[model samples]
Target: MRTLTSSTTRRRLAPLLVTFSACAVLSGAMTPAAFADDARSHEWYLDAMQADSMWKVSSGQGVTVAVVDSGVDPSAPELQGQLVPGEDLNDGKAGETEDRTGHGTEMAALIAGTGAGGGIQGLAPRAKILPLRYNVKAPSMDTAPRGIRYAVDHGARIINMSFGIELPGEIPGLREAIDYADRKGVLMFASSGNAGDKDNVITAPASMAGVVAVGAVDKSLTVTKWSNHGSELALAAPGDDIPMRCANGEGYCSSGGTSQATALASASAALVWSAHPGWTGNQVLRALIETAGRPTEGKVPSEYVGYGFVRPRMVLLEHQGDPGAANVYPLPNGPASASSSPAPSKAGQAVSSAPQHGEAEAAAGSGNTTLWVLLGLGAAVVVGGVAAFVVRRRSA
Candidate 1:
């Protein structure tokens, strides 16, 4: 469970606002020399996250995560040795590791970067990074569903989508791809979006079922006012005043959003999963939701932070966590059913019995996180097995 920051009351913004102002957030600007600064020395969240204490337990080794964003610059000094070969959902090529906006690289650094070149260090430095480049919000008019479908078709274990849109009515191809990924045994995470200060609406993919919605939080451990609030939110993480290497491949800079928080949440999941290989995704998620940080009282979740701010160290260091059912998803979907309760998992139990080729091939085609492609469709069901309701619809 990952969470970010937010305000309890809404602030009225001037009409025709160019860019929504955030409370206590860093602007998205990167300076050239800031990249050469000591990356690890600038990671202030580690101290609050107790990362040093958690690292002694698990470094997220043996875990492969798929980053679905603009693109990742493989040549980044700190990320040089950590990135694995991945696909570009945009043009169906293999050379999409080039970071166009630097946001993806920042996310990659947050997840698995080694901090070798004075770049920001990652929470799980030992974990492998699989970059799946896509353009969900591209300036171009062309649209293709194959990017996400292709990633799901590959071998990604965990899919982290840090981009989003607000299109109404579920698009057939996109929904199908999401369903396909779910059946394949993947654990997908997405940003809750940066729209709280405007329409106050949550974005799709984040609003979709089976995707863990992450929000942003600040050093004070309070939710940021700019983060979107809604029933779609699952957890929150540190997103405000966080430092990252410049977006231009330059030096270090600071910025905040559920985007960065989503990466941190994914890193948190990697830590828990790497330590417990046999545990199903449901078990892993159950531990996170159960151990999340509570900023306000009452069992009922807030529209802003959901269950609470995510505290991965609690799950990694504490030995007490019930994985519940192996097949069942603890979180419920649909607008009427927003909250999730602990349930048993049925995810990997039938892997030996299910048809292993077409679905498996689609899963293998997804990307580096084998689990993402392998089990996403299956995990979308009630208990992590193939859903009776899931339909196989192909994309053009």
Candidate 2:
């Protein structure tokens, strides 16, 4: 029997990817990068992430990320040859080439948008993006499996899904598809949603084992109140007030979203993968997780930021991370090891004042991981297929 609950769809799917979707994520407006020339200074997070130094080691030249969101406009000046043919799960025009909602376009830019036409610069400028366009209105049964299968069947090394749904149903096919990708040595990332201050719940497919659940944080390294927190969280990245192209894929918006965070996380993986071409997805992911900036020591993951903020430069330059078992999963079956929490830092990230939703003190083995059950919705029970739930909703 399949489990039934919400939080199965991608994170930005309900809020940004789907047409006619409801979004309550507060729009903190910022100065949009009008052109690529006007925008280099606008992406302040890149410097915080030390993108330049990391680029000296690896530019992610040979990696391809399958962006499974809205359609993408591959012809965008910044994306010229960086995008390859993908699949269309929804409308036809955007089938792996053009983007409609612009959300997908921005995500593509974040992953590999070159600083061309005075547009936003990507974390991995040489990496390629594969578009996997799907409609929010499509039946869940048909959507999840097909999109995932197509991306894996193709040559996608990393899959980025910044959208999701919060329902009371578990599509086994979706789980199987994720398993297939992992088995094939693909690294998957999805937004943890922007709802941590309220009902900080675990969202899928991030909640699923083997997939990396990414949350949001500002350049200050402080975990934002909006990003959801749970044991599902694998790591955190810059999500608050980022600069990127608007949804139409034409203009720019300085205020980016959690979807951007997921994309950046994916790009980080690509950078590491490109630098170490011989490593498997498991090895690459282990490097990111183990080398991430964390205040707590040992194996325990933070509920809010997981292993803490992603520091690809640490992996590329310092070479401080370990590539554990090539095929073994990293998450602890029981409790992960722990240590005392470190104080907050002046730059970048530090330990938060309070523990993430279910984590414990920094002391050795002091944390507890919790998995919340999905309760029922009122009259409108999502029956046949699941739809992406808005991030602003009370429960997801």
Candidate 3:
């Protein structure tokens, strides 16, 4: 279970503000303090999503997400004891948890931070992180797709890829890894790109079919001017003015990008999955698309904010949030129900672990179609070895 948060772009970096007791202060609702100390403050979106309220029901306790990025610092206060053993794919280092540039550490905290010593709070505080490092920085010509495949083979239920590369064309190996993950029931989320206001191009992994492509938005809920817009987009989240552990790992500051949004979205999915133990990846994703927020004109799921903002509460609150046809896989090229008969069960009922909500529920788009999918959801009927390729070009 993992999901993305959205953010907007600003000329200057915003100061990190402590969002203690924000749910109570903003919504007049009682919620616990994810981080009660003074030194570490997470991005405001955590409180905005009522994370504490959601945590009481399910803190993503049963989910494991593989973070494929520069590297994850396993010693961060918030990440102490959360990182599982992983291998380095760079071929330059054996430890995937050793973060050289600290970007991965920030992403890790945003996904599953424990909020130890006021550290940056995670959207899914109970979820476990499996650090898988790759070269996403300067002077790098490493094939990160190898790392992605390895993570999938491992026990990671979800893959979090925050870095985006605009390769001239899709690499066969990378596509295989992605397709493999999809077949394995592993949900993959990636950043669209940071150069949104300019090229706004669809980056690798994020643009691929069967992948959940995320974009950034601001506190005002408007899509960031820098966020890429077009098909291949699935959902949006809080990406701007996000507070994260600094590069030095000593303090915190506000950062903005589709990267942070991707992490948060992964965490959100984790929460939903942890709550609904019996649901499949399609059901979890369907709930996300079904419950997202939208505007007055009956929710415009634009290329900019695909399916609107990600809101898991709507799914968690419902007893039956569109599990859809269980036997039929959700992806387009994936497997179809071999037998159409209703899934034989003890009772003619569908069970979900999502939390129970009071009369009030989060805003779900008005559209009749509660799911988002331009790609197939069924299990991959075809799996083949992809030819290896030399790293022709690389960037930081």
Candidate 4:
């Protein structure tokens, strides 16, 4: 059993220093008083992704996403009525709402926060959260796998795993749990990892088959330097300088990581799933991949950005993308293809054995430049109600 740890990296903001009342912190009661007045202003991706327009179509009303992390603070203002009954895989003593590291609560808020009392506004504001707590430091590997099974057996349709382990091979129990979830029509998303500039090793369960491995990109749509990359990387999302509720129950903090990217990807799926309530997990994932922003110059499934940045607006607002066959899983190593090829079970094996497309980093840079130009053109069209073309002339 591999020990799981949070994939998020938080940076305290000196300028945004509003703390909850001492009494509230001591009494273990989360209050709205800790939220900063200008917190929402920093949620740049909401506007960039045109969440308001998407919200008009679906707020993920009926979907329940299981957040398997440290824990969740159900009392948080944004999560007041959003959580369902949850379990603590660590020990039955502290329930799922006791958020030890604050990471779980942050992830939950990102997926379904209602923005009450100036709190974070979730992408899928109406969705419900089922918090499943796993002890990060516990030596037992059973916690994560048990949590995954618990979510699948419960009413969860999507599971957001914002934590990861950089292991050389797959843990049988963990892999089996993920496979089980897939069989039950549950879509799983995990942070690829945050060691892009460092070790850059693939992490599990992200590299595992049947899971959507998410990487991070900035407001410019450029893949962040710290987001892990590999053949298993399935998608990218805005993850840089993201704002979230602080763990200390103080004001919000600005942070960035693949963890945030994974949450957004899961939330994006919820939005699509809620709109098309009858769609299977395969169909929903198909829609997401088919509509994702792709590179102009390189073959898709790029190691850096995968199918490209996740743009649910294309599915929700524009009515784009084909939700292909319900029974057929979309990506590699899907259930549809599981029996044919050996499962890419080991992180090291998955990373080393997969065929390398061109230089991933180089491809990503060129593709992002094209994507930015396209986004700029799209913005111009929205403003002017006419198609705009930008031709970049090369110097002779």
lDDT by residue (291-383, candidate 4, tens digit) is 665554444566777776787887887787788667777786664333222212221111112111111111212423332212211241232
RMSD of 4: 9.4
- The candidate with the higher lDDT, 1 or 4, is 4
Candidate 2 residue 312 C-alpha distance from true site, Å: 0.8
Which is better, 1 or 2, measured by TM-score? 2
Estimate, for each residue in 1-396, the C-alpha lDDT of model 1 and write its tens digit.
122212121212222221222333332232222222444544656766778778999988888888877678888877888888877766665366966667778788889988776667899888888886765344222222455566666666677777666666555666666666666656777888776656656766787887788877654444555677788788877776566654444444546778888888898888888888787766787777665643222232446666655667667765645667666666766222233443223321222223321122122123221111121111212333331211111121
In model 4, the Cα lDDT at residue 381 comes to: 23
- The CA-based lDDT of model 2 is what? 0.64
lDDT of 3 by residue, 290-373 (tens): 555433232234456665567776665444346666444443334221212221121122112222221121222333432221
* TM-score: model 1 vs. ground truth: 0.74
For 321-373, candidate 2 gives per-residue lDDT tens digits of 78766666555421111111221121133333342212222322233432111
Once fitted onto the true fold, the runs of candidate 1 whose alpha carbons sit more than 4 angstroms away are 1-37, 92-94, 136-145, 334-396
State TM-scores per candidate. Answer: 0.74, 0.75, 0.74, 0.82
Model 2, residue 89: displacement in angstroms?
1.6
Cα lDDT of candidate 4 equals 0.74
Model 3 segments more than 4 A misplaced: 1-42, 92-94, 138-142, 298-301, 318-320, 327-396
